[model samples]
Target: MHDQNFTSLPDLHGVPVFYPHGTQLIWISSNGEITRPSRETLAAEFALGVVLLCHRRWSAARAAIDIDHYLDVMELFAFVRPARFVLPTPSGLAQQLGLARPQQGEDMAALLPQIAFILLDELASTPDPARTEAGRIATMMTAGGWKWGPYILAHLGLPQPLAGPPDSRYAAIWDRLADYTDYTPQAEPGTQPILPDAARQRLAEMLGENAELRLPQADYAAAVAASFDRPDAGPNPAMVLAEAGTGTGKTLGYLAPATLWAEKNGETVWISTYTRTLQHQIANELTRLYPEAEAHESKVVIRKGRENYLCLLNLEEALAQMPGRPRQAAALGLMVRWAGATRDGDLTGASFPAWLMDLFGRSQTNGPCRPARRMYSCSLPAL
Candidate 1:
């Protein structure tokens, strides 16, 4: 994950600019002297990632983050950073700098803060001078904190601008704020307060007969009128090696218990199967069973590598370069159709041919189905 370009630059201002996964640093001085940190010192500081050189240095390091964490960090870095245009070096930038960019599976530094306070502050309190109020509000909503923002705005009596034609929703509010040219919010539907346990009772009634209707389940359901009654029982962390033959309900046995465990602990459960067929089957079965098991509700999401998803950039490039190519046209057509249907961008369906799957795997930076990043090797859980 260390970059060669990072090896070329002398550290500027006693600060070695490093990305989350990038480790190499070049030292620069006021006297124009460039010196590499000693290998011994680097080893002491960063065992695998440390390197020493005359003018540039490259180092290797080990990380303990898992693939999920790595992806989350990437997301945080990309859209959640407080400072606009502070994005990390993109793949294209790395290429321009002649540095080897870390692979998609690389770990993200754990210590880096990922949340942006500007978005939060604007959503909760006031607008930022740098960002448009609309942009700040939209970003906060997309980042999943809109609920609180709207509620707070309502309580504060701040007027949000109505958008679009004057004949539209904000016609009245616009009349009031038109002179000021400030945005005004259209009135949102008022909510009526329900009985405290109404939702829980409804959920319980919905899951009435399901065996998974334990306290946690009942508490979640609206029909079952009850207080917290379930004891703390969850899966113990362990490395399990099992070899079960056909006719064994291995799929159900694992899925059922693991789904309940996930619900109880509020943790994600990752399931990996050896064969593509098994992957599809397990995902489909889990999806089906989730609705039936009302108390222990779970959502099943199948995630594959990015290549499996329609690569808009690559597709655009292909189309622009080969407008008349029959193969390209056909590929584009198929991608369009698949984009509408595929869930989680997994291009594995009965209609999708095996050859196409192979082609996608080869042509795209499609990562492994399961996150097999080195940092996650030790953290993978057993079914």
Candidate 2:
């Protein structure tokens, strides 16, 4: 209904308009519950026209257009619409055909002429009333899929110029829209030891092993005994920055205290290291001794920032819009694949390089230092 009679009508957002042969007036209505004729909707309707033409293998079409063309044709409708168009072929089909080569300078503008010609050819070839209507309907779907242009046209009240070759100014507009391709058929805070007894014990051992410390048998016994006697035998928020001087059983000293405190205080005991070597040393030591703690340690995640959490929402949006580096794109893709099942935001499938390690910290919560850290009484005893 729209393609044949409404092609030349102005975009009035989503409103609809009708013209009668030799008639002085056209009927117009806003697209609400009633759905009036507008350029916004018409643009979408036209996009569907592109898709239909593309589908039927009609890749060339032409409509007589002039400076007045923009104003006059849309006058038939109720609103102005986006003047945007793609040239070589519709993005939907181009991707489908697997001929979606990277776009270049003139690709977008060049495709518009081809699409215009294609539409003209399709209209010329169609004979059946139902088939012709069906073709038009399909075009609507394809065009509607592209919501950006219609939105800009409707909201911004921009005129779709119908004059000669689009100027450099308009080329910038096209360039901005170079990659609106629809692709792929795919889908906070708080500390405290919430882990179960078994999980807690596992966590304790994991931390102990991570520090790779072996306090003297006497020290380990004393720390564990001290933890057992404390009002609560779990970790407290204590800052422990251990520097090994010569042969200080640094591993033993760190492990005994971390394990005992975490187990006793019932809180996560964060161990920040200045070097990757230290981080690994603690991890290896802890794992070697308390293998059972490995799983819990894995759960003891190193959260960085909100951006690291796979941000499935932002990822899909970015992909659709086309932004960021190739690495970013790849990271988002990996995130899309793994994020659904990951609660802690840890991606065990791939190793995050040291350079990328800092990216995870982007998600860290900002605030005054933790209260536990500020108060000595609350700080877990390091002895």
Q: Give the TM-score of candidate 1.
A: 0.30
Instruction: Output the lDDT of residue 226, model 2.
Output: 33
159-242 per-residue lDDT for model 2 (tens digits): 333222212121111121122222223222222322223333433454454554434432433333332233344467322233
Q: Candidate 1 lDDT (Cα, whole model)?
A: 0.33
For model 2 the local lDDT of residue 208 reads 56
Q: What is the TM-score of each candidate against the true structure?
A: 0.30, 0.29
Cα lDDT of model 1 by residue, 236-290, tens digit: 4233354455644455544544444455555556777667678777766664445
Worst 10 residues of 2 by lDDT: 74-83
Superposing all C-alpha atoms, what RMSD in Å does each candidate have to the true structure?
24.4, 21.4
Model 1 spans with C-alpha error above 4 angstroms: 1-237, 292-298, 305-307, 324-327, 351-383
